[model samples]
Structure formats: structure tokens, C-alpha cells
Target chain A: MTKNDLEQLIETHGNEIYQFCYHLTGCREDADDLYQETLFKAYEIRKKIDKSDVDSPLLKERNYVLGIAIRLQKNLYRKKSRRKEELLDNEQFEYQTELASDFNTEEKVEKDQILAYLRKIIHSLPLKQRKVIYLFYFADMSVKDIGKLLRIPEGTVKSRLNAAKNALRIKMEEKGYE
Target chain B: MNNEEMIREALKLNIDAPEEINEKVLRNAKHKNQGVVFFKVATLAASFCIMTIVGTGLIVKASTGKRLIEYLRGLIDNRSYVYENGTDTIMTVYDNNGEKWEHVEYLDDEVTMSHPLSENETEYNLYLKVTGENGMEHFMNVTAKVNEGQSSEDLYWAIRGDFYRFFSPYTAADEKSQILAGLKEAADNADKDFIRDALIDVSADLENNRRILYEDWPADIWGGEGRYIFFEDLSDLPVGKCIIIINTVYDDEDSFIFEINIDGNQLYVNDVSFNKYSEEYYQEQLEKNLPIYDLR
Candidate 1:
């Protein structure tokens, strides 16, 4: 919980947490602010984090930091959409305007469409299911890791992931995508 | 790209953070005393507990109460027996606020000129779009399958079961004739008695739900999960093979004609499009079910 420990946590896990926040918010600006907020929040309560498990210090720290980010993201979402019950209002879901790669080719165009559809479906998902999906699929986190980060049972994480997958499949099918 | 691949690609976009994030974190952490930190942590923990308890309560209520059944029914009721070019049909449910509760595409095409539902595979996925209590729409895609495969004798009962699931919560006792007209329109010579019995069951179920819930009969309850219909008589009703033609009538509103051969005779069942069958239609049909149009 010292300043040195905080600096090390940021250096080692900061980018990962940043990625998590970016996917959670689906916007870079929000991610940056949330990333900083999460680090500070984690540092504030660093003394309370269960530190007895010396076998996985980084893992413990990652969970603590990511947990704060997720809660903050939920709070932000609730605040943003308090007037409307829609879980992911269109205004809150801002995608990057520029694609990461060039997409002048036909194949890339198709890929872009599919990816956009995927993003829409992901954003369409309920908050809980969306979190599990982003962490598992986008963040490349293991189900066990996600369960720990979300503070839920691993089985619950698995179920939520399955539900999200099924819902996505149905939506993709609706759009004539197998 | 597949979902995982697409997500990986999306997440791969390097997210830039402000350079001053480190300084901000250090300053905020330094400003927080041990007591303040403890207080914030304690407050967060308490909030989490309250959220969990309230969430669990809502989930339990939704699952066991009207919400779950309404959601389940929305999935099933959106299905229709119609010819698709060997292509899947989809059903999407949306709440009043235009938020989708369920979107189920890739439903197995179970209809042809001859067979409406496959005898081999009774399992069918229904896409439901429902508006939740908050007026936001929810979507669900659920499989409607009975474990035991149904025989032709079970078809009427199955149809009746579906009818009950579809209408009981929505249609009142006085509106029984509308259901009869609709069913009669679907299958000509539909036994008035059989249809009446199903209607009565629906009304009874609605009454029971109203009594138990101690609330007014929610209009949303009509199509949902609680329908498990069983007709005592195992005797098969007479149904003959006849060419059935389905066409939408655009000139006189978006009504549909379900023309079928019944008992070596042509029968016509025409009414408003099932998709548009709403509270307004319920009221309209209360006076007189729409007149049938004969194409044969």
C-alpha cells in the first residue's frame, strides 16, 4: 500500500486495467478517466485487500484494481442513463471513428461490418452479462480471473458468458450472419 | 470475424491514458487518511451488500412471478406456422419503450405446404421481444419443446396448449368468441366446443393468477411461460388435407387470410395480422371477430 507499491502496480498492471476500462466504456476518453479513478480507489483501500495469499500478489492486485474499475463503470452507466432504463443507450456507446486497420478491401469491409455488429450486440447485452463477456472475450481474462475480479462465483461467470454467447448468436443470425 | 476474434481486434486498439494519471493517483491516495479510506471502503461494502440483497430479491420475484412467465411466453408466442423458403424465421420482442428483450433468429423452419410442425423434432426456438415493467424492452430467444414427441392427436391439444399460453392472460372471459374466430380461421371447422374449452381454461388461469398475485390482471400476462395445457380426451379430431393459402390483405388494413381445406371443404380464416394483435384488436374483436374471406 506504499507509494512505491502503488507505482509498481501502475507500471505492471496499469495498461491491462486501461484496456479493461476502455472495453467497459467503449470510449477512450472515459477509459482514461476511469483508469485513473480506479488506481486511486484501489490505492485508498489497499490496506484492506487480502494480502495473505503471497502466491499470487499480482493476481490479487489485478482483481482489486479491476474491481474498482468495474464498479466505477457501473456507477457511471447508471448515472448516464438514469432517465432512461436502456442498459446501453446509444449516446453512451461511442465507438472509435477510425478503424485500427485500413478497410478499403472487400474482405476487410465485410469483417468491419461483422465486428460492428458484434460490438452492437455486446453493447446491447445487460450490464452483468456484458461485463463477463468483455472480460472473458475482449480482455482475454480467464473465467476464474473474471469471477475473482467481479467477486462472483466462477460458475456464475460461466453461465453469464454462455447466456451472452447464445444471445449474440441469435442476434447475428437475425442480421443474416451465421 | 467470429465474436472472440472481433472482440480481440476491437480491444487491440491501443487505449491512450492521460500522462498525469500517475500524479493524480498519488495525490488522491496521499490526501486520503486511514480513517477516510476505512470509511469509503466500509460504505462501498455496505452498498454492495444492499445491492446484492435487493438484486436477489428482484430476481426471485421476476423468476417466479409474472415477469418470468411473460418473458417466456413472448418467446413462444412470436412463432407462427408459415412457409419460409427453407430459411429460418425470427421473432424479436421489444418493450413499450422500443428496447428489445429478446431477438431470436435461426428458428428451425418447421413449416411447409403439408406439415406445420415437424413430427421428428418438436423442439422450436421462439424469439420474443417484451417490454419490462420499466417500459424498456427486453429480448429472449427460448426453445419451446415438450420432452415427449407429440402425435397427430396431440396436434389439437398442442395447438390448444399454445392457444392457452398465448391468450389466457390477455383475453378476458367476454372475449372468448374472438379467440374462437381466430382459431376457426386458422383451421376450418375448428370445434366450437374445443375452442370454448380452451378459452375457459385461459380465463380460469387468469382469474387464478389475479387472485394469487392480489393485483389486477396485468395485460402483459397473456403470452408467457406458465401455460402447460392438457386436454383429457385423447380422441383425434377430424382434419383433412387441403391446400392452405396465406396472404396479407393490405387494402383493408394489414389483415391476413388463412385459407385451409377442412373436411373436404374449403374454409377461410381471416383476421388482423397476428403481430398486430394488441389491446386495441382485443377491444375491436370483442364486438365481432373479423369476417373471414374465402379465396377458394
Candidate 2:
């Protein structure tokens, strides 16, 4: 693929990719770094695909780019784990508050609170379950697609999704949510 | 709301990336692409130069002459002497005691440089096996910085970093003797607490020394507890016959064997022997359902 093709790909799918990165990292700074590194790696390895494949569907290109983002995020997670660094919980709470301001009504505020709580819970999930949750719910990917992207079986993807949901349900119940 | 709807709703809110990110990513992508292009061009140019020099007879001879000149310059530099004998490039450097040491920089089959270069700044903690004047192998841990632009040869000569004498059976006998005295005194008093404390101190020292020697401790052997030093049941033995065995499993197939022999209040460390086992032997023992420590 040419640089022009990569430029267009990023232009089209940059927001979704960045959102996936944010959900993966739970912080804007790490999301930014992961996003930039993902694009740089995609550009570096662009020649791996045939030039004629440039005419492939936009969905395939988006998945290709997202695949790079997933692998890089996994590696970043591994390095961070080695260093024993935890994600900034305060950053997530601050971001949720900032996001809550955009909604005006009391019902919207309540919904935003629930959403923020869910986000925190999701972030606290183990890496595998969190990844499955992000790709499935946020990225709008199918179980099979997640399996293909993560190189796991579809059954494993379904199991992870179920396990993540169960964990979220347990946390929500503990917080006195129905 | 249901779980799926709640999750989708939560993820969808404020999902847009900061507006500047697109431009930043594009700039980074372009910059990285340019670096890749430059690297490819440089590699191609170097390959072409080498090919041309090899293709021309007089240029090859001139290249040899240039190498000889570099070798002669190295000989005069007193700090180091670099010369090629047949296929091996040997670098000679004098130790602090004025003893000459020759390291083969480039062998015929492989490059045995002391340090390898990486693309980014990497701090390498390495255990260097240096043969002392007594011809006994002594292991020392050295931390070296290998910057991106620096070559391995430069790193080999300019390794000025923190060095720790990681335990050698021969050189560190005096230190071992001190530990033995401490253990003996604690044992003679019939102070089990002091004995345990002494054993714990020895365990901590062994953990630090072994951690430097082998960075990655296998999680299976450690049971993910992150503890390497295991003490055999010290409570069962009597006071005078208190034999403390400190077994440190450094890797799957190797361990640092430390034995404290306290026969009738005479305490001494037998030896700090680093024992290694072959993979086949380890697997065979595993198949026989024997404990890993028994394989030693």
C-alpha cells in the first residue's frame, strides 16, 4: 500500500482506532501514544500487503489497521505489566466527570454516572476479558471477527465475553445496581 | 438498561479522539516512513560499495591496506590493540594489574562481541565470566548502556558502569567464612530465632545474586509466588544438628545449591555450587514423577 492509501485509511478510521486505544488503556496519554505507534507500525509494514489489495473493501483495511492496534496494545500491556504499573484510576474518574458535563438533564446525568461506573468496571477487568469487551461492545466486532483478530477460537471469544459480563454484573450488584 | 446497551452507551460517549491526533498521527507516520526509506537507501548504498570493492582487484587490495593501517593505528593507541589474524579480529586490552587480555571480536563463524547493539537505548545487566589469575572462573554482574548510534566494539572497550561481584566459590571465600562465623555463633547459643534470621539473610543475598545472574525466574517453579529461596523444614531438626538447606531455583533446569552444615553446633556453608541439568534429564525425571530438587 502507498502512503496515500495509509493516509486515507487513518483519516477515515482514526477516531474508532483512537477510541479502541482509549478503552484499551483507559487514559488519553497512553491512548495517544498507542494510536500514534499503531499508525507508524501500520505504515512501516504496509508493503506486506499487495499494492493491488489497496482496492480491497474499506472494512478489511479498517480491520487490518485495528489488528495492528490490538497487537501493539498487547505488547504495551506486557511491558507495563513487567514494570508493575497500574492504570491511573483518578484519570478515569476525572474523564468521566468531564464527560458528564456535556449532558444537561437529571436523567442524562444518572445515565452518565452509570456509564462511568461501567467504564471503570470494564477497565478493571483482566486484559483478555477487557479486550474482548472492547472489541465486541465498543468496536462493534462479531465474536468470530474478534477470534480472527486475536487468533483465538470463536468459542474462546464467546467464553471471554461471557466471563467479562459476569464480572461486570457482579461488580454492579455489589454497587447496589439491579 | 441491559448490559449490551449500557456497554455500547458507555463506550460511545465522548469517544471521539482529540482533534489534533489525526495530524499528529499523520506526521508521525510520514516521519517513520522517511526513516525507513533512508535506512533502506543507506543499506543499499553500503551493499553497492562492498560489491564494487569486491568486484575490483586493486580496490580489494586497497581495502586490505586500509584495514592494516587501522590495525597499526590501534596497536599504537596503547588503550587497545585491534588486529586480524586470518579470519579472527582480536582486541587486546590490559587489565588494572597490567595483565594482557585478548578477546576475539570477530570469529570466523560468529561475532563474539561483548555487547550487542539495539535500535534504542537499552540497559543490559550481564554476568561476565572472567577467569582470574588463579585460573578460576569468577562471575561479575555489569550494567552497560548500549545507545542507538554506538557500535558494539565501542561498547566493549568503553564499559564504565556499576559492577558487582556476584558470588564466586573461590574469590569470595572470605565473605563466606564471615557468614559461617555468624551462623556458628547463632547456632552455638541454641538461638533458633537467630539461626532462622541468619538463614533468611543468606536467602536474601542468594536471591539478589541469582536475580542478577538470571533475570527471568520461571513462574512454574516459583508457583507465581515470586519467591526463589525455599527452606527445607528447619523446625524438625534439633538445635545442635540444625542443618539449614537453602535451595534457590533460578530456572527450570538449574538451581543455586546452598547447604549450611551445622553438625553439633559447628555451622558452615558447604559450597555455593551452581548446578545445571540437561533438558532431557529434567523431562525424564518429571516423567518419573520425582520432585525437581531431587534431580540435583
Candidate 3:
């Protein structure tokens, strides 16, 4: 892919990519760093990709970017774990209160509270389960696609999804959310 | 909303990338485009030089009647070897003062120095040979630690270099300065929990398939021998007691623990210990042919 093609690709899928990073990291600072690294790494990889392969469908491109993001995020987590960096804490939830100004007070408050709880719970899930959940729910990917991306059996993907959903359900019910 | 709907809604929350990142990415793309040609040329030139050097080295070795060192299949980092039985065995080729020694771990305990070499002489009967410049050869028999359970002292030598390198980046002056700055900020804010939490996070991260225990420093642990010491001079500061118990990722038998003392803002590691596990557990794992851990 040429520079212009990459620019166009980023322009089209940048938000989704950034959102994926945000969900993976649970913090804006880390998300920003991860997103930038993902884009740059994608660019570097794209340069080596065959020109004929560049014309593949937009969905393939999206998957390609997400794949790079997943690997980069995993590596980042491993490095942070090795360094014994500070854990992701309550500070990530600080932005939940700053939701869209368009929503009315009660609606906004309820939405913010639910989102804060959901994010914290999701963040606390094991990395494998969290990845499946993110790909399935946020990225709107199929079980087959997630399996292909993660290099796991489709049954494994479904099981991880089920496990993640069950955990979320338990946590939500405990919070009195129906 | 139902559970799935609630999850979908939470995940679908609209989040936008920061505008600065977009601009930075575009700038980087433009810069990369300019440098691509140069990078390709430099890479080609470097590859050519490497090929020439390798070609010359191989020719010289062939002319000198020196045997080429052939590593076993599935050798990783010239240290660990993966057996077909799914065991991640530690096979280190050691060079000590021109004397070459190979430490190879086998899956079973039946193989020993006295065991007869198989007919093929390929799979079994591996030997560590030291060759002098004059082509004088000395053969040494090296045994797998699985046969005779590894001692703590043996594990200390085997794993300390890896542990040291893993944590060496944090020992740099700039890294220490950064850590101290963060610690001082937390200290000034009286966030002792943050300091302790940070340490706990470190402990939790390193506790992958390994047990970590916080204990008091015992003088008998190191026996006054401080050869593997990372940090020694912390006599001036008040140090808190925090010890990390590390099970060797290589084998299940040995447990090594080191104490980390937090003195004001500085962190000092004092004393080391290696404790052995029950022989039964080691033998059971061997009999089951189970991989201790997946290094991949």
C-alpha cells in the first residue's frame, strides 16, 4: 500500500481501531499509545504486502489492522507485566462521567454508571476472554472470524465467548442490573 | 435491557481517536515514504555483507577440517530444546574457558551415563567435546538433571542470568531515576497504598505459573555468599521487608526466593534462597511426560 492508500485506510477505520485499543487497554493514555503504534506498525507491514493483495476487500483490511492491534497490545501487556508497571486502576473510569452532552441528566447518569461498571468488569476479565468479548461485541466479528484471527478453533472461540458472557452476567446481576 | 443487549450497548459506546494521533500518523507515513528507498538499499547491502562473511567462514572451516556445530532440531536461542513429547526441556550449550559443555534435559529418568548408546547413536549418547586449537579432543559425560533432582545451588547458576537480564532494564540510571521520581511523587502525596500496589502488581505479573511469597529475610538463606547480588549498598536507609519466592520456570523441583527491601525511595534486593521440591512430584511430572511450561 502506498502512503495515500494507508492514509485513506486510517481515515476510514481509525475510530474503530482506536476504540479497539481503548477497550483493550481500559485507559485513554495507553489506548492512544497503542493506537499510534498499531497504525505505524500496520504501515510498515503494509509496505511489504504484495500490491495485488492491497486491493482486497475493506473487511480484510479492517481485520488486518485489528490483527496487528491485537498482537501489539499483547506484546505491550507482556512488557508492562515484566516491568511490574502499575496496574490499571480506578483512574480509567474517571472519564465515564464525561459522556455526551446531548443526553438528559438521568439518562446520562444511568448510562455513565452502567458503562463504568461494564468497563471495569470487562477489564478485570482474563485477557483471552476479554479479547473474544471485544471482537464479538465491539468489532461485530463472527465466531469463525475471531477464531481465524486468534488462531484458535471455532469451538474454543465460542467457549471463551460463553465464559466471558457468563462472567459479565454474574457481575451485572450482582450490581442489580437486570 | 437483557445481558447481551447491555454488553452490546456498553461495547458500542462511541469513542473517537484523538486528532493529534491522526496528524502524527500522517506525518510518519510521509516520512516513511521518503526513507523507504534508503532502507531497502541499506538492507540489501547488509544482507550481501553477511552472506559474504558467512561464505568465507564456512570455506575456512571446511579447509581447516573443523566440524560444523549442528544444533538439534527445534533448538531455541541455543538454550532450550523442545522434544517431540511436548516437553520444553532446558538444553544449554555452555562454553567455559574454551571447555565446551552441553546440559541436555531428557524426558525420562532412565537414560544415564552408564546406559548403552543406541545403534543409531543420533538420538541418545550425546557427548560434550572440548577441542583445542591443535585438535586435541576431550570428551565429558553430562547428565540430565531429571535423573538426579536438581539442587537449589545448581538452579541458582542456571536461572540467575536470565532473571538478572529480565530485570536489568529497570536497573539503568534513567529507569531508576524515573521510578524514584514516581515513588517520590506518591510519597509526597502519602499514597503508600499506591507504592505497595505497584509492588504487588510487579509480584502478580511475575507470578505466571510460579509461586511468590512475601517473607522475612533469614541469614541462612544466602549463607553470607553474595555472588549473585544485584544491589548491595542500602545500609543508610530504612528498609521494609518484602521477599519474592520464585519457582524456576525451567524445572519444577527448585524454588528460589530473593528479598526486596524498599528503603525510602530506593529498592534493594537482599539475600537469595533455593529450596527443593519433593522427589515424588518431579518424578510424577516426568512419568506423565507433561511440559513444565510452554516457552513459546
Could you give candidate 2's per-residue lDDT for residues B170-255 as a string of tens digits? Answer: 23554444333433332343323422343344434433332112111112222233223222323233332111223343335334
Model 3 segments more than 4 A misplaced: A47-56, A82-108, B36-296
Clash number for candidate 2: 0
In order, candidate lDDTs are 0.44, 0.46, 0.47
The candidate scoring highest on TM-score is 3
Tens-place lDDT per residue, model 3, B1-296, is 67777777777646688989999888877865543211111111100000000111011110110121254221111112122112122345444222233343322321211111111112211122222224332222211111012233332232222222232224444433433343233234332343234333433323321222222211122222212212122333244533333443333433543323343432323222212234543443344332332111
Query: Model 2 residue B94 lDDT?
Result: 25
Model 2 reproduces a share of the real contacts of 0.41
Clashing pairs in 2: none
Q: What lDDT is reached at residue B136 by model 2?
A: 36
Off by over 4 Å in 2: A47-56, A82-85, A89-103, B18-21, B31-296
lDDT for predicted candidate 1 compared with the true structure:
0.44
Docking class of 1: incorrect
Q: Give the higher-DockQ candidate: 1 or 2.
A: 2
